[model samples]
Target chain A: DQQVKQNSPSLSVQEGRISILNCDYTNSMFDYFLWYKKYPAEGPTFLISISSIKDKNEDGRFTVFLNKSAKHLSLHIVPSQPGDSAVYFCAAIEGGATNKLIFGTGTLLAVQP
Target chain B: DTAVSQTPKYLVTQMGNDKSIKCEQNLGHDTMYWYKQDSKKFLKIMFSYNNKELIINETVPNRFSPKSPDKAHLNLHINSLELGDSAVYFCASSQEPGYTDTQYFGPGTRLTVL
Candidate 1:
């Protein structure tokens, strides 16, 4: 069964606008979450991550917000650029003895210039 | 230099054939992992190795085997490949065997079983 889920398959936004992608998890044991961006024919690149204790984390134009009560998290890219277009995957880990990352189905984001 | 590299960008073979995929990392990481992205686009972990020792083994078939020659190299060999074996395989590495260490992924190898 899929513990992490991203219901949205695709999203489109104009350049310079804020783009938001959402993800949810059913397992409460996951203590860490991460987001990865992947381009066509290329491997996923690490974007940002957040711990279960922290509610929010920000790095430059990318920000991740977590809501433990809702069992959900989101990735926000402010002032989105055309280069930001790619498939975004949300991954979660239990973080103690297990390092295996459970990845979601992924969301395809398109930024129109 | 490429931090992680995988040989054979694409492989197409008939059913029941045997093949191997090689992966190498120059980042001096101590952990390596193999992940498969199937048709549904779900990336699932197949195996993980830390310092050339098997750590995490998923519910994969016996036809699939992972071998690590050293800390920097991990190879996946599949025998009696089936039609469902078609997928994109990715090799990744980390400095340690923990989630705190960010994993770096390779370009991925597309395997198609006919």
Candidate 2:
């Protein structure tokens, strides 16, 4: 049972354009969500996160919008750059002291220069 | 100055063999975890230890054992490996066991069973 799902296996966008990555979750108990960027042969790096209470969070060129009612969230990168090409994994923090993360299969984003 | 490091980045062994993977974190985090990414690219948590104590153990097989000798080091030993055991294993750490804590992951260890 995949609680978190990134239906899109891959995405392509042109440089300086908008890049949007979407993710959905089945479990409503998840209170926190995060996005991670991973390159080949490298581990995932934390990109940004948002709490269930907040609808949106922005950091520089990256923004995350959460729609609790829809049980969906998306990461938007304005003016995407070629270096932004990587596998993006959406994760949710299961409600518990352990803070166990449920990760999606990941979406590979390719930015064409 | 790597925050998280795992030894034996690649491991190849035959079925029914026993092997171990070592992980260390110098970030002074109090929690460590082991995750497996299968061929489907699904990342699943196998075990988590906090301050050298077992805290979370998912529905993993008994053949997989995790040992945390200290807060900074966590090791995994697999016995009677099977073809299904071939996957990439990642080691991660967090400052504390909280939902808000960000985890730092290692480069990952690819285990191949023949």
Every model's DockQ: 0.81, 0.89
Q: State which candidate has the highest DockQ.
A: 2
Q: Calculate each model's fnat, 2 decimals.
A: 0.73, 0.89
The clash count for each model shown is: 0, 0
Question: Which portions of model 2 show Cα errors greater than 4 Å?
Answer: none
DockQ metric, candidate 1: 0.81
Which residue runs does candidate 1 get wrong by more than 4 Å?
none
lDDT of 2: 0.96
Candidate 2 residue B1 C-alpha distance from true site, Å? 1.3
Q: Interface root mean square deviation for model 2, in Å?
A: 0.8
Error of 1 at A7 (Å): 0.5
